[model samples]
Target: MKSILVIHHGQGVGGGLIALLGLIAELKENNRVHVLSIFDGIAVDYIRQTGATVTVAKSRFYAKFYQLFIHSDAAYFNIIDSIRNNKSVILYYLSKYYFAGKELKNIVFDYEIVYLNSIFISDWARASKLAKKKVVIHVREPLSRGLFKFKYEIIRQTINKYCDQVIAISHDNASRLDLQHKTTVVYDPVVTKNRSQSEYKLINRKFKYFVYLGGMARIKGFEQLVESLEYLDENIRIFFLGGESEYASHGLKRLVRQNLDPFFLKNKRLIDKLKKSGKIIHVGLVDDVFYYYENSIAAICPFSKPHASLPILEAFSVGKPVIVSDVKGMEELVDSTNGVFFINSDPESLAHKINEMSQVTEQDYEAMRTACMTKYKQIRERSDSVTSVLNRT
Candidate 1:
């Protein structure tokens, strides 16, 4: 069996982490897998549960310190922004990365392949290359134009210099990164073997809920989902089953963002009002979301940005249809046969689509469920794409 070391940027339990867990689950079946998580969070336990050895590096402090130099995409490409942002701490930030590379060398010698879960773990890629271990990077996010293009150039250079193979989660992601020549499009697999499989009974309630699984970030169009409540039928309720984002999860940051950030402030008021009205239900993070998916009529992913969501795949794996925003990475996954698409960031359109989903006749819903299961089976068939690449000499 191949020895694979998976590196994860473990800040939150977002789709990337879930995708990595799914990959680990698959890899452990035929290979020896070890996960090195950059920081400790909710995902550590999940990673350990996969029967793979996992180590938490306790680097959250270092990661936050590094962020002081390059906080955003603009800082990466704009010289003036980069200088202004890192003028005081550039030396320290650079030193941290240097030491991190040194530390990685000590860890990678025992592994044959170092698999980076996302492009964000470039340091691991570099260190793995230096150790002469095969480096495989999973490019999960899309590379757009403008300053992002500059960031892409940097990423391109990294892959050309360091990575033996690059895996993009979608064709859009591969094209956007301009890495089609060396990139493999592997859809993230859904980990269903460990999930609870209770009998799914359609809830006999007046209000049918649509499940939303992800972080509470603006990019996720959560606020937009809340606003859509104004347009949705009273019988339709949305059940949000996720936690706060990395940016707004801590003390002062959370307090300030929840109070000052217009997005959060507005959504807070609306969510509170809707929760009481029974139009919105917030059931924080759960260990297993199968029950929620089984009880709901459909799953909803109203992401404003281009995202390859694990929740959509997980929902489909359980024979549940999805109402997703018509965005690049997501739209390509679902179509009219198994899911309904709404205009990205448009609350009215989202509500309309949610209404459309709720109104689907039981007979039609059964057909959609069949289609969803078919899609899930197709994905599972190709789930070994990453493992296949790793097994290559």
Candidate 2:
């Protein structure tokens, strides 16, 4: 059996998890496959659940430890901040062993293949390129996250120079590749839950509410979603189902709650106050997302800036209408007849689109649902397999 390795940087929490699971199912019987990534990974859980022999180099502190010693100087700056805000020194030391254990994995990685997940590595200094063998770089992000600051562009360019291929998830991203000869378009393989028709929690058919799933990032259009709620005609309630601020776009739900403080008063006051006023129903973070989508009339992706998002496609698979930002990446999957597209980051436009679609008859709603279902199947075919790509490489 041909032995292979798949490297992943923690990116889209669900999409990445889905892709890895699908890949293992497809590749395992055909060849021996190995996976290397940080600990507490979604991929690691899926692998363990499937009874596969994969490896994890993660712990609560390992990621930070790796950054401090093995990652780039720029990465170390952030690590120092995390360390200074130290809960404990022994905790930091315990976690930094990513370098100690897996640092030499590339040496014995000799059954044959290598796969790098995105261009997130600054440890290219330590690992040697497999010149005789082909390498695949999976492209999930639009560009390098901290490429310039960490001099990762030099590493990316070196990867471009030495790696055999780069696999991008969308055609729009693939077509613009700087390294045309080595570039390939492999649409992300999205595996969705089979929706049961009878399960929709249409508590009030006429009383419509929309759901937005994922993080509360500015790029995700949470600010515009709140603004759209203000312009809305009060009949349709807007619901946001997501976790709050990890970075710049974090704390938005709190900001919204603070802004509306004068309007109400109660013990569990902030979120409850908003829900009572019917401005925004903050669903908080959920474990099983299908439960929320099945009940919602429409699912939303209102990004202030456009990048391909997984939730919009997931909404389609669950047979719900999607109202999303009309930007390049977001607009690519939508069909006007299947779903509605609104002006990006404009609350009034988002609200208008919601009002228009939420009023559709049950039969009409089902037709749009059917059309979206058709689109989801097409993506699975069009996107090439990562293992298949590596096998060809």
Candidate 3:
């Protein structure tokens, strides 16, 4: 069987997981497939669901600081312990990779392909160019606003040359940076939830709820979206459902406080208000977001930040009216025909779009929803494209 190694940087339930799922679907067919995840999260559960054995780096701390001290004593011990016992991992990491960062002298792989994630760690592998291994450099986000100026040029430039192939979550993201040749645009795959989607159909006469999904990461424009809610009529509720980013969720919480003060009171009161008048549902990380989307009127992804996002697609897949910012990857997926796009990423513009959505007719909304599902199907079919490339190599 062909040998293939898959690496993941962080374990957020985002594009990486879908990419992992896609790769697993494609690469594991009649091959000795192995995975090395730098971090762990819900994605780990999904990866295991694919039935592939996951052999994480002995020291994931090595992923970012492997050259220095190995992070996660547990992982360090696991790898060392396994190696010392001579427990032969069918597919395994190189010794030096955990012990000596860039100094990782040699990697003995008879495999034809090494599909990798995280530009920080494995980028070195590509840079080392020790063998004829095909490397798939997966990038899910654009550099931060500050780094967008020039800070990333060094690393990105290196990626242009070192990487054998480049896979971006969206074409807009690929074009956003000065990437070199051999780049392919692969949209993030939709996570298929076992739970059925919400059956609540959006009434096109006027929107009742506005939705946004994603951990409250810095680039999601969380504060701005929450702040904008103050200007809109209280009749419409804005529901947020996603994990909160450890760093930025605090600011998002603060913004929520500001929006609710002197306005919304108790949960029962808010529920009653929404029932009588629409109110926001803060269902954090629901089992099936499609359920929420089906009930909701419009799926909102007005992220002003520079990164790829998935909520927009999740909303579209279920035929929800989507409203997003006309920036980066979002621009590629959302258009006036399929969904609404606001040029201005401000509260007023957002509120205006919400107001506009409130006026869409049922027929027009259905047409837009149909357009979105068509696009969703096209993207879904390409979900395993990266895995195909990795296995073929």
Per-residue alpha-carbon lDDT of candidate 1 for residues 1-393, written as tens digits (9 for 90 to 100): 988888875666766766677778778898888888776667788788778787766444454554322232211233444455445245333533474575565464377888888765665566677777899998776654544455445556767788989888877777776767778888877655545555645465888788887646666777678778888888887777787544456688677666555555566675575466557677677656778888888998888777677788889888999988876767677989999889886899999999988898999999999999999898878655788888883
Q: What is candidate 2's lDDT per residue for 342-366, written digit by digit as tens?
A: 9875778998888888788889999
- lDDT for predicted candidate 2 compared with the true structure: 0.61
* CA RMSD, predictions in order: 4.2, 7.3, 9.8
**lDDT by residue for model 3 (1-393), tens:** 678766665366754566567557666777778666555545777788888776555554444433311111112133333343232211123422333233322334445666666544434454334555566777665633232334345446656766777777767567654464777777766666453555645434354777777535424555456656656765676777766534223477546544543322332243343334234456666556666677777887767654566777777788886877766566677777778877545767887788788668998888888998888887787554665555455
Q: What clash pairs does model 2 have?
A: 39-58, 62-95, 65-96, 245-250
lDDT of each: 0.72, 0.61, 0.59
Model 3 error, position 116 (Å): 1.4
- The TM-score that candidate 3 achieves is 0.72
Q: List ranges where model 1 is wrong by over 4 Å.
A: 58-64, 68-97, 197-202, 245-264, 382-384
Task: Say which prediction, candidate 1 or candidate 3, comes out ahead on lDDT.
Answer: 1
Better of 1 and 3 by TM-score: 1
